[model samples]
Target: MTEANSTPSVSLKLLVLVAILVVFAVVIVLLIFFLCLRGSRSWKRRKLAVKHSSGSIPLVSKEIMVVKTSDLTPATTSEIGDVEGDPKKEADVKVDIGAVTAGKSEVSGGGAHRSEVSVEDPNIGWGRWYSMSEVELATRGFAEGNVIGEGGYGVVYRGILQDGSVVAVKNLLNNKGQAEKEFKVEVEAIGKVRHKNLVRLVGYCAEGARRMLVYEYVDNGNLEQWLHGDVGPVSPLTWDIRMRIATGTAKGLAYLHEGLEPKVVHRDIKSSNILLDKNWNAKVSDFGLAKLLGSEKTHVTTRVMGTFGYVAPEYASSGMLNERSDVYSFGVLLMEIITGRSPIDYSRPPGEMNLVDWFKAMVASRRSEELVDPLIEIPPSPRSLKRVLLICLRCIDLDVVKRPKMGQIVHMLETDDFPFRSELRTVREKDPVSSHADVSIKVPYPPPKHAETVEKSRWR
Candidate 1:
């Protein structure tokens, strides 16, 4: 009786152990099922949220905001030494897309078009989304004749909207992955950026795999055409006009660098990117590769991307980028403006192949006047030309830390006083009789004392 009872007890224990194991397994399976269901619901909710946010402008992400420097009521001078230069202390420029005409005359506030939207509107945000069909109709079925410009991003076509307004539509390349990325980047960078000098983004189209961006139509061609096109032996851009273009370009860049809260770094700052309207006002265009930088971050380690010959050495080598990189490119652009030469020309003799090297050589040899574009109708005065050249050199300094902020650049460009005016005065104090003897000391624009002697001795 005892043996039989013990065997039964052992069997019962085994059975209990099996039952416990089975129960644990079932519990695990149910838990997994519950987790999967919760995850699925979360994913669906996210998708729906994106869909709902599509038609209307979505709130700006933390990484980027549609905030301008003027909105913050910045101090007169940046704590980091970036100076804001406005001769009249005018209010921020406001642009109206609806009233924009391709070749309109300047309105009251120096803008080509009148502004309908107030800068203070909180509702103001990125542009609207257009159906693919609407874009197709606007471009007239993407006719070859409608193509106004072509770039690495895609082809730019001139489209006439139903409202009788003209627009430049960029049909992004069909590389599915890259096209989408660029579309998002451009929309974020350009949308809601309100500056007279910036090409305003009218709208965009993202249907299926296709991507398109519409910009305000600029009637006059880009700065590249004015500088290098087949205009004739004598270019129509007078010294005053060139200065105006330069100053405007500087102001636009200053706005981007210092005027915005999280500043915009225009990775590319070449002549081709500077668009001009009928009034010859310089509007900085092409933000396809632009990057936004918050005040907290000193730099971003990004894949080096920009036009060759304009890339800053520090950025190109290490892929570390900041506002200084834009300054470097702007310096190269200034060289192009002053010399009327491409940044890199393979056809030229080896010594002159690179514009930067050639320019440095010219400056070192005191042949600055020789490097001027012969086409310029009226030559800039010795002092004025020298000031611009010095600024350019300062911008391109290999020691990136030494480059001036864009606002400082604007102030230097617009101010008639030479940067080294004190040094010249000191020399004059030491040698009172020969104060004007040094031809290099004179500033630009209005000729200095002993102008005839300086003109005959140095400028010629």
Candidate 2:
């Protein structure tokens, strides 16, 4: 009985040993599998780090390609070197770029070959970026002979680009503080504006401490030269030409005030700012003092900056600025155009020293014909003369609310209707009692009741 019991105990001990060995084997297998998975993960992380640190990483999905030429062409994903993609797709990229460059040269009339292509900066809006060296070459090193105009702001030089395109370059006075601000304002204001009556901004150069603006070359001179310059006694500008200029200027101002999203107040509008092209079309230039007002705002409160005689009463006195201020300046310009008199001429007699005062006095006395410029070869008729005088008076109205908008002024100037109708009570419609049939007699209105009408009015 003792031998049988010992045999059963040995069998039980063997079974327990077998169970412990199986558990140990399972634990070792699990540990080995976990270590292998951790090693693979670590290797992958190191590989990614190596790629980034070595500067071999791929670019973002969206790639930018800039074209230096006048035209812009969209580039394919494979064209950008750093971007990751199918290796086979990039084989023809170099050939495609070459073709584009060649095509640009041909299209631009074979100027200096500029093959270097890179991404464009967003800060330079709407205009090409010109290097200082390029500007210097075009202006012939800013030679004195190249200067077409000089003013407090800067000097304007006529230039011809490598492409044989004529351009006017304005070299701004580098006062450091003020010039920088003016450059920013001018570029932001007129950079993208394209109108027949507005000078076009071709490009700009802001290199080192210098600031310059390139504009389309207007062959004919400015209005100031034609109006005030020595033209051998008899002025070349006929009455009709003067009217055309006035109409064009009004249209340009209308676009600025009503057509643009953020209306621009020219701040300085005078005869000097109106440029004439080859066809005698008016182009409004020099926006150095332009200010922008949002649609939500009625006016901008800012420093009173404008020509002394052209500045409006409200603006010059209280600094309340709006589109009406520009209208006031335009009125002064119209008077200048009409009388050929400086806005403030000390040379005139005491009472006639101020053109605005003299103009109002003359009209009040019904001597409006005396206000015409003597230099004009053919004088304006009584009706046309009175209409323009009324329009001018409306623009320069002391009450800003009574002043006509630029659009209304343009319509009034273009149309022959007397005392152009407006919301202002000053411009009253004809009395209903007066027979409408009298309008059939297209004859111009007779002279003022007190004064005897002259066959041909001679300006004093």
Query: How far is each candidate from the true structure, as Cα RMSD in Å?
Result: 17.5, 16.3
Which runs of model 1 end up more than 4 angstroms from their true locations? 1-124, 423-460
- Which regions of candidate 2 deviate over 4 angstroms? 1-125, 419-460
Give one digit per residue, the lDDT tens place, for model 2 in 5-78: 99999999999999999999999999999999999999999977744432211212132323455553222111
- Number of clashing pairs, model 1? 5
lDDT of 1 by residue, 210-314 (tens): 667889999998999999899998988777787788888888999988888677888888899999998889999988677777788788777667887788878
**The 10-residue segment with the lowest total lDDT in model 2:** 90-99
